[model samples]
Target: MEVEKARVLIVGAGGVGIMAAYALEVGGKAAVTLVMRSNYRRAQDAGISIDSVDHGKGIREWRPTEIRNTIPDVSQEGIPPFDFILVTTKNIPDVPPTVADLVAPAVSPGHTAIVLSQNGLNIERPLLARFPQNPILSSVSMISTTETSPAVVVHDFADAQKIGPFVPQPAAEAAARRYVAVYNGSGRLADVVYDADVPRARWHKLVYNASFNPVAAALRMDTARMRMSRHVVDDLVRPIMLEVVAAARAAGHVLPPDLPDALIRVDPVEAAFRPSMCQDADKGNLMEIETIVGEPLREGEARGVPMPTLRTVYGILKGLQLQTKVAKGLWEPAFDDDNPYR
Candidate 1:
């Protein structure tokens, strides 16, 4: 008997989303449908072109089985309910459409598995609350990818994608493993691992993101400069990481004791990398401040864990974001008595 292929709906067309689409297509194990709101015409016309050191030298293109402009379009085009829905968009809480809203149209409450392939802490809370019966999985990736244009992506370095069940149900674990198998079967430079300790894995990745992303974005420098300054790494980076660990512990996730030191030992190659937050700052785009930093700070505050370092960094990033908005004429600076930073 022939096996039925999994139907996947990828909601974002950014670097991570395209990379996942490429892998699933190359694996030939799933029928992938990409929801590219801005790049639907480009992707439909020329497909997605990937230039990667891991995949080869030149530009290679791969088209998903279907490309739609919106989630409602998927059903309107006679597509069935997706077996798996992958959300690779930034987890910004202040954003107009929440992740739950974005994926709601395409998923069946109990039948579809939802995968969040974005950064940050407490990302699954709203999703779990909204879709109580669905298997919600979380993923953390070390890959460095950038979308240079509408249909073009560049993969700088490929790393393993760690996936795990957020709720840890048997069905969730099975779904996570199936997704892992699909990625591993692809000939791309993907090393997918199904992690049993999903929360721990998220906290482990947070150590690096919380430390480096905001610092780099605030200073408008690459990771190389941030890592090169011994004072910066020792004074700023280490403290921020320790605060994240503390917050994780306060939230009931006990990460490894040496996680801070492990995150501090940055690779020289990765030092030259520009994190997503830095890139967004460079382009004057909105950063994922709330999910990446603010949410964790709130967690710490609720648990009575003092996170002075994280709070300080969060304030700086928020200031930067406000300045950027003011510069772009999107915001006006007004004096408010309730503003603590004022």
Candidate 2:
């Protein structure tokens, strides 16, 4: 059977969402829409741009992109339903984090099977409960792209995707042609990884994210610096990666050997790259400390695995993130209402 063309709705016009839009626009992959909850005025100011900060390939070109939102606003009066929903928000959502709930009603089971492309786990469980019938695909994205504007998002690296049906969906040979279409159309990214064990890939990315982002955010250094510095890795990162690996094994996934070493060996081009955690901390926004760092530590304990290094990383990174949040006076957080804005 020929797959029906999908109407893509990308939530959160941050780096990932915008890049998804760029991918669609470049590929003309599917009819795409961009929905953002914050910095919306900016979206209105400058629309989607395809950007890559790897080596100054940053460029912003406005494609015919639709802008909707998760907050209640004047602009979101009547928008069409979506076939493919890409939720790019964080697993550790900011206060009043109800956008996911609100967006659920707008998606029908026939047209909606969301691809969770966030940095961590635990975001989909709650959504799964609410949308019990809708098939939620748990996905892992390994590319590291940076975005500050709607029209421009910088691609940091290229990695494949691992996607599988989660909760009430058939796990078979599925085609992600619509989702993969977007990345390939533009110079945004290359490669779509299907038919792989999603749990392993997700855990793999989680381990890598936990190891680098938190330490980088805490120390305000890029992954390259973290890899090259012996004191940093031996004393800090290596141990954390070990703990994360232990946790993944407990959860029935084992990363490849030499992963800790391989992750550290960065090319000179990427040596100075700041991770998303560091970027969020610097911007005074909430960080995914819990998802990226805490979940593995907790999972390890539940599965009788020892994760001393990860526990320490979680403690330090969570402390730093909270301290920053307190300093900015955005501390007393509230989960957002599930109200669709646009």
Candidate 3:
């Protein structure tokens, strides 16, 4: 007869989260609710305005079924538990209230599948530890999008969104495939792919993110400028990318040998785009240094693979993060002989 609309709760109101919400609502496949801490009021007032080249000229505005400031707010309002909890926030483990903590309240075991649409490696560790019985899905987005204002977002380009089960359980895989169907049926904005090799897909994306994201933040330049400089590409970008491949191999995920070269040759049209890490740095927001760079470096070290380039870039980005905090008066520099980078 009729199909039931899947209920999805998006935990973050950033670019990715907003984009996912827009896609789901537009597709009519899910009843979406967004937990936007800062933009709840604005989103409720004006809805979300998406200026997307992928979606074309007119600004697409969508109001989810409800927008609440927090998970507790949803519970207080008597909203039902979400069928899926999609986390599109940055993977900052050191930050208080980890992803697991944020989605714990609304998670229904066996019913709710936690989808982590984030960058970096081993991101599902905490969630797996916290909710051992729940189905966890790892997702990687190739789309370029940015939230320009409280209620306005800009989508530059979208290549694909790959998803797979984090733990390889049948229930988890089924859940992941169902989520994929929703996106693929939704005008193919993401060009969703059911990646069987989750680790390889993660490492493949890491080859690009681990190399460019930190470098862009450290150098304070966009991708176009970074790619334009041969010295930067050869000396910095390519080196870091190779290190990622090495690290991935050491961690038992062997990526393509030519992946680094392919990543360095940025498409001229999307060249001007700044990665999320660089955008976060520009706004004095904390970058995902530990997750995006540090975790892989640690993995390599554990596997006896030396990632000198990744290590150096990780240190630089961490130092930049500390500087941003100090400038914001959130942290004070300690006058000690010990090197914080070390």
Candidate 4:
């Protein structure tokens, strides 16, 4: 008897999505299908170019087990039910067609496992609310990879995936373990640990993400420049991170006292690194403000914690996002309150 491979559908073909697809395909235990939209033609015609530090160098034109321009509907011919649906897109909740809607067509109730490999805080709530029976694996990815261009990915720094179940039921735990096993089969990844407390892991990671990502975008600075700016790091970044720490603690996820310092002091190798939010801002795309900064702030405030610094940053990013949306014509500007146009 021959063993069957796990059929996996990756919904987003961004940097983290492509990286996940590559790792799964290279692992050889699963068949990975990547859904590409914008770069679909580029990926099909030229193939995805990988310049990865972990998976070795000079590997050009890499394709997954399968690539579809759109998410595969279960009714589609020759498309098998996917065991895992990985969503690696940015967690921008203000946008329409929520992530739940994007992956709902292919989701097999109580069977298809959902994995969120994106950024932000408290991101699992919407999915859990929509797909009540399915296993939700909330993952915090600690990798410095970027889609430099269409169909091109550059992974320079560490790559680690800390995932766990949202509810921690038997099915959820099993899904978490199986996903870890499949991902670990690659044997090249630095770390792919199954976290017992995924929410805590999320809060801990947010200490770095909620601080550096938006601040970097706001200042238009890379990791090196942010570090070089004594006032910026000391005054703005450090205080924001402390606020996150307080919020996490308020929410019952007690993080280490020195964790902020640990993340603030990045390795010299990752000096030129820019966060995803910064990249999004640079490309004139909508920044992920609400989920990354808003949700946690709300959670903290509800619990009587004051996040003054984080609140200020969130307000600034929200204003910037408003301007970006108006420029893109996704939103209309309302200047005068009494104007009919407003």
Give the 10-residue window scoring lowest on summed lDDT in candidate 4.
266-275
Model 3 C-alpha lDDT per residue in residues 287-324, reported as the tens digit of each score: 89888899889988898887888888888988898887
Candidate ordering by TM-score (highest first) = 4, 3, 1, 2
Model 3 regions more than 4 Å off: 53-56, 59-61, 72-78, 187-190, 269-271, 328-330, 334-342
How well does candidate 1 match the true structure, expressed as C-alpha RMSD? 2.8
TM-score of candidate 2 to 2 decimals: 0.81
- Lowest lDDT 10-mer window, candidate 3? 72-81
Indicate the residue-level lDDT of 123 in model 3.
Answer: 88
Clashing pairs in 3: none
Clashes, model 4: 0
| Clashes within 3 Å, all models in order | 0, 23, 0, 0
lDDT of 2 at 291: 67
- Show where candidate 4 strays beyond 4 Å: 76-78, 267-270, 335-342
Q: Give a tens-digit lDDT track for model 2, residues 125-229.
A: 777777665666666876667664434566767545666655433522243434555445554454555534666776787766888788888888877776667
TM-score of each: 0.89, 0.81, 0.91, 0.94
- Report the error of model 3 at residue 326, Å: 2.9
